[model samples]
Target chain A: AQSVAQPEDQVNVAEGNPLTVKCTYSVSGNPYLFWYVQYPNRGLQFLLKYITGDNLVKGSYGFEAEFNKSQTSFHLKKPSALVSDSALYFCAVRALGGSSNTGKLIFGQGTTLQVKP
Target chain B: EAGVTQSPTHLIKTRGQQATLRCSPISGHTSVYWYQQALGLGLQFLLWYDEGEERNRGNFPPRFSGRQFPNYSSELNVNALELEDSALYLCASRMTGSHNEQFFGPGTRLTVL
Candidate 1:
């Protein structure tokens, strides 16, 4: 079965410092990875996705993720952390072929990013 | 273009009651997906519909069901609701493509007493 794991329950980062929210995935075939952020009482907002191409994929709000094939990891990153960037981050994976064609995503237990000023 | 939209931003029901949630997909989107965001379960895929057909579903019970309309709008019906069913129900839509990303709506908060 396809699955996503976000090792951290919460990541604390100081303002102006870089932040990294870790994510790892398991899938039978090639994986389409995605990142989404949710704020208090709001729905999830798409951050970025790794379908194909460059290992590093940039997304909304100055955030980017590196898709490492060998490591089976797609880590969300930001060079400078801001208080507004704090939110719940989720990693999801969809298998490329076979019965997984339904496009249903397997999501990880979310990680909360807390950026302190 | 308008994004995915869901109605009844909040719904409250008692156990054993039935609850209905509605969603409107983005224009031109042919696929609709429903997910449940519970307290600790993360996000679980509930159903997937494409071209007015039920393409697939997750490991949820039969009480959780839904259908898509000809215009691509959809409705989720939960029968025999339980306290565990209290959650944020999210609706998402995507164009008919393997690589396209899904857009989400402001989910409905369902509370079961």
Candidate 2:
């Protein structure tokens, strides 16, 4: 089984400050980790993914995530937080091996990030 | 190229009724995925269709079903709708062997009365 855990329901950061949203996962095999952002009333937008190689993956909107295999974590990060970045973030995982070639993702409960000006 | 697209941006249905949501994959894409985003539940995988075949489904009941067309479009049909079924239904598409990075549509807001 594959699962993702976003320990924080909400994270607050000041504008211009760095922000991090924590995510951890449990999977049977090598994990394909992803980060997605959802604005109000909109669908999820892909942010970044860690398929293989490179522990640090940069994505759209000045966002990035670091994949830690030992920690089983893929945490979203931003060098400088902006008010526009305030939205819901989700961490998702998919197993790379086994009979699971369906490409179905298991998403976390989501973390709401609030960047205050 | 155009991103994934979904139809009927908003839908309303009463309990016991059925709701049909549609999706069109991106050009050259061969897979479609459906997800349900309900309050408190976040996003739950609903179905995965690749090459006009149902490759995988989540733990949803039989009432939640869908099919993919020859052109790689897809439709999600939810039978016996309940109030709890009211949520945003999101559709995503991906190219085969594309590292499983899916592009999502704006999604349909389904409100079950």
Candidate 3:
């Protein structure tokens, strides 16, 4: 079985400061990890993903994540925070096994990050 | 190209009633996925369809059912709905080969009273 965990329910940061939102996963085979952001009344938007190589993957909106196999973590990072970046973030995972996807995305509870100016 | 689109931006149904939500995948995309996001809760996987077939499903009950049409459009049907069924239903779509980059719709707000 595959699972994801976002240990923190919320995170706070000041605008212009660096920020990080942690995520961890557990899956049988190689994991396909993803990060998504959701704004009030808006749909969940894809931020980035970690399918294979390149431990550090850059994504939309100056966001990036580092995949650590030994730590079993894929944490989202931003060089500098912005008030607009404040939103609910979710971590997800799917395993690749056979012809089709091995399983559905097991999502984390999500973290509400508040970035103040 | 247009992204995923869902019908009935908002819906309200009493307990035990049925609710049906529709979704249209991006042009040329052949896979659709359904997820339920309850207020204060994260995305809960519901079902997945590819090439007009049910490729996989989550741990949700049988009441949470759906179907995919030949054109890659889909419908999610919730039977015997209860008050706890209130949540936002998201529909996402992607090309068969590139399932990871799924595009999502604005979502349908389903309220079971």
Candidate 4:
């Protein structure tokens, strides 16, 4: 089985402050992690993914995430938050070794990040 | 180039009625995927079509079905729709053998009433 967990329901931050939204995963094999942000009534937009190499991964809209294998965590981070950065964030994981081509994504419950001005 | 596109941004249907959702993949993409985003639920994989064949499907019932066209566009048909079928149906496309990234469309919102 494969799954991702986002521990925070909502994280509020003042503009210009750094923000972090945590995510952890459980999978039979190594995990291929992803981050997507969804604004209200919109489809999710891909932010970044952690496939292999480089524990640190950068994504769109000035966001990044660090993958920690020992802790099975891939936490999303932003150096300085902006009001436009506020949205629903989701963490997803897929088994590194799985039925080839099934290629399904198991997603976390999602976290809402609100950056206030 | 155009991104993935889905039709009928919003649809309302009564219980037991059938519904069909359409999607046109990115110009050169060959793999089309369908996902269900119901309220309070994360995106759930519903179907995958590639090269005019059904590749893999999620744990959805047979009533949930779809097909890919020669042009790589696809259609998802829900037979005997139930109230629970109300969701934002998302269509995504990836080039063949893409290791990770899949581009998504705006998605079709289906309302059951």
Docking class of 4: medium
lDDT of 1 by residue, A1-117 (tens): 678999999999999999999999989988999999999988889999999999999999999999999999999999999999989999999887877777898899999999999
Each candidate's clash count: 0, 0, 0, 0
lDDT of 1 by residue, B1-100 (tens): 8889998999999999999999999999999999999998899999999999999999999999999999999999999999999999999999988898
Docking class of 1: high
- i-RMS for every candidate: 0.7, 0.8, 1.8, 1.1
lDDT of 4 by residue, A1-117 (tens): 677899999999999999999999998876788999999988879999998899999999899999999999999999999999989999988675656337667889999999999
**lDDT (C-alpha) at residue B110 in model 2:** 98
Give the top-scoring candidate (lDDT): 1
Worst 10 residues of 4 chain A by lDDT: A96-105
- Judged by TM-score, which candidate is best? 1
Per-residue lDDT for B3-70 in model 2, tens only? 88898999999999999999999999999999999998889999999999999999899999999999
Q: Which stretches of candidate 2 lie over 4 Å from their true place?
A: none
Per-residue lDDT tens digits of candidate 4, residues B1-113?
98888999999999999999999999889989999999987789999899999988999999999999999999999999999999999998988764657778999999988
Chain A in model 4: its TM-score?
0.95
Worst 10 residues of 2 chain A by lDDT: A94-103
Which whole-number lDDT from 0 to 100 does residue B55 have in model 3?
Answer: 84
Give the Cα error of residue A96 in candidate 4, in Å.
Answer: 3.3
lDDT of candidate 3 over A1-117, digit per residue (tens):
567999999999999999999999988778888999999887889999998989999999999999999999999999999999999999888777764353467789999999999
- Reference contacts preserved by each model: 0.85, 0.90, 0.59, 0.54
> How far does residue A72 in candidate 1 sit from its true spot (Å)?
0.4
Question: By summed lDDT, which 10 consecutive residues of candidate 1 chain A come out lowest?
Answer: A94-103
**What are the runs in model 4 whose C-alpha is more than 4 Å off?**
A98-101
